[model samples]
Target: MATSRGGSNLHWRNSNPATDSIRGGSAQRGIRGGRGSRGGRGGRGGGNASTPKRDPPPEPDIVAHPLGELLQTIRISDLSLEAIKTSKPTDITDLKYVASYNWMEGDAPTIMIPGKPPAWTPLKQPLRLKEDAGTYFRDPNGAQYPRYPAEPAVQAILNSNPTFPTSEIDIFACGSTMGNLLRFVRASSKAFRFSVEVVGKTVFFVRKENSPKEVIENIHGFGHSFPEAYTTWEEDTKGSSSHQRIVQYNFGGLVCVMRFECDGYLRDGTNQVDQKLSSSATSDENDNIIVQALKNTSVSHVFSTTDESLSIKTGGNEVHQQSIFDLKTRSGKYKRDIDMSDFLPVLWLKQIPNFIIAYHDGAGLFRDIRVQDIRNDLRVWGQEHKDDIQQLAVLLNKITKIATEDTRGLLEVYCAGHDLEVRRQHGDGVHSLPHSLRAEWEGMSDEAEESDDSLGATNGHGRSNFSYGDEDENDSSDEDKDFTACSADTCGYCGTCSY
Candidate 1:
């Protein structure tokens, strides 16, 4: 949480190669690499025999959310490129910024207006960095849902002066859900599963596994510590721990809204929108709703109760989508490259135009750092991966169609390695929003259709879209296939699977 290390000494490392390599090895041992163990490494930066963590700590205990229940399961084969060629390929279009909020460190779930990310303030010279410690939530609010991962986002939307249209939107998801589907399209070899439920016309994809809060363990890098050492939260939005942003776009024919975590932003909130567009090789489709986020507070929750936990504090500068960036830290010892093949899709999903990567010696001294604006690069990658993207569009359309067929409205999506399945959610599964908020969100159906129409989101011959934990007697009867998400043993990477 300290401000980025500062100095005017931006120079490549000039240290003994053999000595630095040994020190980097010790540094790696001091870090845990995934979301579950995000900031929980507690040993010195030494890979010594005495380090207790040489044996990783156990994964978190996650079970018995009253909501995850299987109503039905429809199995289908892996989507093929050949099959995609036969069907009309869907293209993502009409991207736009919808709403955003920051999490407050408090007892109940709270919101900060026009929430902003940490500012990018790199230190002038490389310095020995401290390691991260303690626990972190994959999603602080989501970890506490029935779960309504999208509830706070929608509430933040409605509370704005001019809310984005919601009626015609076909799907509401997070980066993990969509990314899982995209992986299926590309035919990935990993195992993954999530829940899908329908509230109104929008299908919500929730990634509620066994444990929402996880203990840090089994890590070997500086992904957490690097950011703590390098980035600083700006003044206006102080006291915030995490920021979530929502973006809407038409992929294939479906009008989609997705929420993602933002790392931080460039301090100079200049005309990044214009700058991004000027540099992009594509058209306005990439320019859908990047800048229309919430501004003023005008809360009007008809179902407002004195106990409502959502409080939108008024403060924060409007951060242009283009000015924001995704960050990753790596060790320079292995000379490992930052794989764009993996990172690009994430940037594309969030419409992030900038990426920052810092590479440090094992001793925690960062010397090789790069900040890039890769909007055009993402466009090119999308085109190159057009087949996978098209399959994703088709898959989404199918899920949407089938989920709507069930009168129950509530549903779940489970992808058991190799094939995709759509099932019924536990009747007890929590609603995506509170009763009042749910009513308000569904009521937006009136204007969402107009927005969907204007944006040209197609609803057929194309796709659709999944969370939570709770143990049930029914879980005993359910078959555990290649992966069983309800147990810590199967919650790949212990909830921070190698994404």
Candidate 2:
């Protein structure tokens, strides 16, 4: 039922109309009340009636009261806009790829496996969109592990041969939580909710997407269908569902870990594997730095499969960061000039360099398709939005500080009309990891602190044996190197029996 759009003026950059000091809640018009029963004075029946009003008394300069003792509210109007805008992010020293994984096509929470993202295999011939309905994932992560959306990433990292260093990380978040905070700092329109929990020094920020079945209304475009027709899941990841990658970076003195879902990657062609998405994605050596890093960490753990409810497998090739891309399909009938401003922030947040916008006629025929490398646009956006980013850093610092100080670990952040409030979680809050993992993580944190202090470390700063690669060739024993070990810790995918 989709249409083809024509004559696309796909400008790589669409200037943002908004200035700084932005906040939500405006353009909310009140409804006109019905005519009064008296039908007198300034009622609807009182035609052309005007009443002379007396001047009201001036209000006092009172402080905005807190919603609750524990509840902390954040509103743009309450803060100094100039100060936040001029604020420069300081002490951001390190940034690196933390860990990555894909939500495999299964369930444990019904064969929850780490399935790498599918490769970009484009088709030469045009095909019917609606007619051929292929399998796809709406919310693969949420659906697979309904308990926690971030569980797979944690599982994947801990399950790898070289376990994660819980002490080094100050924050663990996905694109949703990070985006929500950024949106709040940038004074975006839509309201968002997320959960925050303090696990040792690492504060976990998990996204609360309506529910396990996150409803996406009015998805009538080719966003889903177009990709199905154009890209093909390669041989290794043929049965896999969705891909997600995690990156670690330092911003405003905090070592933050962020996870993001990849749409697909661009190859030289279907046959040529491991090619950069664009010229911008590569240098003289062919592979970009991110690609090499991805290659170093990329490894598979063969897992057992179950029936229809869940299908777990391994042997999927990892797509490098530079080759990854995000795609959007819009109706090309009106020859609309799609803006890049709205899309650039998301791409930058995800570290996605390539963007594809496809236009189709009303009846499912796309011709005006263009692939754009928006690295330059992202750089410009980052420069322009430095204030917003700085505000984000400040806000993050504030949240982390509050969460760390609080005795009760679980907290919820809710923003509606005007105020953004952080309160003690009402119900049983979602746990980031299993009890075993939490214990191990907290134990290691203590160990790292003790180790730092004993070694005359300044302000007790230290890292606990962190490695990017899943399998460390140099450090592995004969059993580990020979793949003879199969514990729940070694292979997170296995529930029991090496599955």
Query: TM-scores of all models?
Result: 0.69, 0.66
Query: lDDT (CA) for every model shown?
Result: 0.55, 0.51
Candidate 2: residue 313 lDDT (0-100) = 39
Question: Any runs in candidate 2 off by more than 4 Å, and if so which?
Answer: 1-70, 78-95, 107-114, 131-139, 161-163, 268-314, 454-499
For every candidate, C-alpha RMSD to the true structure in Å: 14.1, 18.4
Task: State the lDDT of candidate 1 residue by residue for 237-341, as single tens digits.
Answer: 766666778888887678888887787776552311111223343333322221111011111111111233566786676777776777766666766655567
**Worst lDDT window (10 residues) for model 1?**
293-302
RMSD of 2: 18.4
Report the alpha-carbon TM-score of model 2 versus the true structure: 0.66
Best by lDDT: 1
Tell me the TM-score of model 1: 0.69
